[model samples]
Target: MPHTGHHLRAVFRRPDFRRLLSARLTFQGADGVFQAGLTGTILFNPDRQTSAMAIALGFAVLLLPYSLIGPFAGVLLDRWSRRNVLIIANIVRAAVVPAVAAMIWVGIAAEAFLPLVLIVVGGTRLVSAAVSAALPHVVDEKELVTANSFISTAGGLAYAVGIAAAMGLRPLFGASDHGYAIIALMSVLGYVGTALVIRKFTPNELGPDDVPDSGGVSVARLAWHELRTGAQHLAARKNAAGALLVVVGMRVFFGAALIAVVLLYRNYFTADGFFRTHETGLGQIMFASAAGNLIAAGITPAATRLFGTRQWLGMLLPLAAAAQLGLGILFTMPGLIAASFLVAIASQGARLVAETTLQTECADEYRGRVFSVFDTLFNACLVLGLVAGAAFLPETGKSYAALIVISVGYGLLAAGYLWLSRGSTLPVMPAKPKTEPAQALTQLR
Candidate 1:
């Protein structure tokens, strides 16, 4: 196999791949800015009282409704032009951010605040699903793992950069609602940029390629049939299905850990030395995780090549479990930060493999629906984890019980994934068709 650098270069040589990646980085960065600003206002603002239940409720309000819509969105992706989806979704998000910012500005009721934010959040999810489904169109099958790593890692880094930029600008903007509102407004630039970049592609450039006929069916019934068809297709691909299950389990664990960390920073830890404030401490932890993601992006392609996709994923799940037990149990700032770094590496690495598996195994026509299912399950499980953590964890977020449960869950999930993946063969790149010397020479050129 060629060096990872060579694979990256080959992938980047494709024009559509670069364009799609540009759009992904832009909107995901916007997502980071929007999310960081929103969290700062809801969780860290001194004027408001935040608790575990409030946090859980906030997640449910933001995620569950959109998750319900996710499958329908998937069906639409299959029927409609995905290029239009990306363009329109970003435009809707750009329009929605100011409304959210305005709500924050006017001190809108939580009831009003959450629903409006949900629109923006839901749009972001839609764009993400579309992007994942569209990726296979731009890159060759042989380069899928490397291509996934590049996009995932780069997009994650873009998100982290957006967060860091928001945090840095927070002091300048002030930690008040007005400041967060301004920060929220900053995301509009990213949204607009993404929309413009996606416009460069033709309508069918990123595609379902073949759309199933609706044939005189009612809209509602058609959607249901399409969704069911997508589900049945996924069910038949056991490797892809198993990868999704592992992803769901990992999201649950990560979600609970996130809630615990947020509470710890808000209520448990005190300011000292580098941890000048709770918000600062949380930012540091986020940066640490981002760093781990960066490292994973660099190493995962090689790791997967060495161990095979399923085996590497199997190794990562246990590593996450060990990180929780060995480091997270300490419950100190440094301990949590270090633990977060390792957990991030494991999480990002596993996701890279899972994404490749889905893209490789599932047919293009079903890809959109399958990914939408993936998105729905991903968010729904995260919300489940948040709610569960809130029910059991204290105000201070210290709970040996919660930590132990999460760790044990990871261990069991690892065992289950390994068993589920048994006898699944590794994906092999197709050999290039033979060509005449003149044609081959021309292609090389």
Candidate 2:
């Protein structure tokens, strides 16, 4: 609790951290613009026929493979220059996204759409992994908690700004493939800006041991071996591992809720002028959720301090569960939107605690790989939730059964967390003593 204020200000003062934050904000803001356009065009459009399974497939296409790919590719972050990865990945994305946007504008087949979306989405995930891995390089470990909070919150707000921009422009441009192409094209340029921003950092600022070479097996074997090593490191840290599981649980619950909300807004809500259309209504709900996410970052540290990190996380999980079921009971317009805000806060708050815990508890050497594993779990669970919603939700998106399942699932997560940490009062890990970034970079070269 003490010095938290000073530390928050101190985080903003670091020049390199500011550059890193700029990279993240620019990239994520572009992502928001791209996503908002896509959702408006494909998912929420009243003119287009959409289905639950179709929605599931669309989401799974963007997310699920990255789950498989993150850890395997994380070996790159550890072994290669992460700054280069950031630069190259964003550049590649800048090239690829316009192609994807073109396909959307031309009304490509579903099969074609998925593959292109995969390339762009996969690149985005890599950029995100690189940022998380490189984060400790710019800021002191003492500031890691607040730094992560500020960085993530700023990223979310940037994303919301992007979404708002899409909303504002859609009327002028029309919510069609042309509009999607235009918005996504702009994001491509934003990705290039992100590339230039990361250029401020040196090649080796991010990390892996600076061994000159490796006596190795095949590349796949090497990647598998490295992933296993990361798993072992994560396995050794019980509380960090537990926290990750909790975050994954949150993703699953919200993933299902997301699909449900999309369907609910699309079909069940009266389009007879109360909100004008489902897209407008859903956009507002998402905006509220985004605001809650931004707000959560500010509150998480204090909440964790008042109730220990593990305890605070334990409380948030059930609150999320209650929010889900409460929405089930209310099952009305204002109710759904308001409940979404509450659920968003709990989920985002819980997620921040997990990120801070993993970043702090894991050693620097293994940080990238651990984050990869966490992201993998996160994507997989989210895909699973989306698929589950597809299975349970009707065309109307009103499924009491699905809500019950989501609530029970979150309840199990809450109970599981409290049960695991029942007797032991585990302490949070502070930043480890380390060489300065300049010295680390010197050694790296």
Candidate 3:
């Protein structure tokens, strides 16, 4: 399983990988649709009547719960059948989207939509956990990095395409509640498609490998203990723990930048109030940022090879810091756009590499718990960043103080990253699972 020119091609042609890819693409594609549809109702809609605080509040509420208890809840993924989790989660999403869509058709969207979106986001997060846990099951251990790169990068591209399509599709549907309703419904195809794709997987194929002699610990008890367990696990792997911290710190800065970008485009960058509504403006910038993600996907594997994971990650933190400072001082439309792309590259590059580190460093039995911790911190940091931005951003998103504070924060983060990554390297071999037959598994029988 050493590197080969055709190895990537071989991975794709694999039947199980193909099915999983179908599930991923369809789900991610739908995520684009769901997001695009919501834009008309929330983020970018000119008619929606939003303010800087409102946008930040919306995201904060949406992601906060997952971050708080998400890891503990995510431990269920290891105990439950991953196959059923994907299958049930996707189908349930398909069944539920139309209800939200129907609510959109009424004027109650402001009240009802956020809650509905919360459900949709929950389902999406669950599916994501299942997929990440299941991935190692489908591909060879040696191929984890490249395989993940292809899957993640391609899924991101698919999501961007969905967002781009939503831009046009909403207008065709008239960019109103009714229009959003139609777009909301479009996500159903992805959910249903993914559910069907996952049906091909036998129940235990995705695995915890069935730990025996458990002393019959209740799942509820396991849940209570899992977070502590995950923390202890991380404490032991200093480099792995450091890598997770790097991602968390990066997200704090990322959140503030998001607020700045939204404020800049929505209120400030309307081509002197002549062209580009906030919706279009945000979309244009998102497309550009997404393109940076695609570019990162292509280069990260090679970059990791040359620089090594710790060194590459250490370098990315400072680069993102530099970009934020440039955007803060320059504060021009072009500068804002450039900052968006640079951050996207740095963020995606860091995440992809960090994920590879996690999968390789942590034992398979604890991966779900580990990822849950990862997801919880990942999301919690986003809210923290947004909250920070809201505190500093003016109505127009043009506060120099805000920019300076963010830049200073990024400088601190970069310093911490340097301290952590000083002499470490990504381990070549995966950590061994502690238990025999490792953990839990489920069978239809």
Predicted model with the maximum TM-score = 1
**TM-scores for all candidates?**
0.94, 0.92, 0.91
lDDT string, candidate 3, 1-445, tens digits: 2343345776776789888888899999999998788766876554578777777888877788777667865687777788898998888888888888887778574655787677788777778767887788888766666777778888888888888888878668987888888988999998998888899989888876653344788876777787688778766766667766777887887888788878877777657442354667777678768887877776776677666666676677777777878765687766776777887888888887777666665667777777777888888888888888887788678887777777777678768866756766543222222232211110000
- Regions of model 1 farther than 4 Å from truth: 427-445
Candidate order by TM-score, highest to lowest?
Answer: 1, 2, 3
What lDDT score is found at residue 440 in candidate 1?
15
Deviation (Å) of 402 in candidate 2: 1.7
Report RMSD for candidate 1: 5.0
Candidate 3 global TM-score: 0.91
TM-score of 2: 0.92
Candidate 1 lDDT over residue span 1-445, tens digit each: 3677878888999999999999999998999899989989888877667789888989999999989989988888888899999999889989989998998877765567888899888998898889989998898866766788789888988988888899999989999888999999999999999999999999998997998788999867888888898898767766667767887888888888889998998888888777644777888988889888888878777876676667777788899999999999998988898999999898888777667666766678887887888889999999999998888889889999999999999999989878867885553122222222111110000
Report the number of the highest-lDDT candidate: 1
Overall local distance difference test of candidate 1 = 0.83
When superposed on Cα atoms, how far off is each prediction in RMSD?
Answer: 5.0, 4.5, 5.0
Higher-lDDT candidate of 1 and 2: 1
Error of 1 at 434 (Å): 15
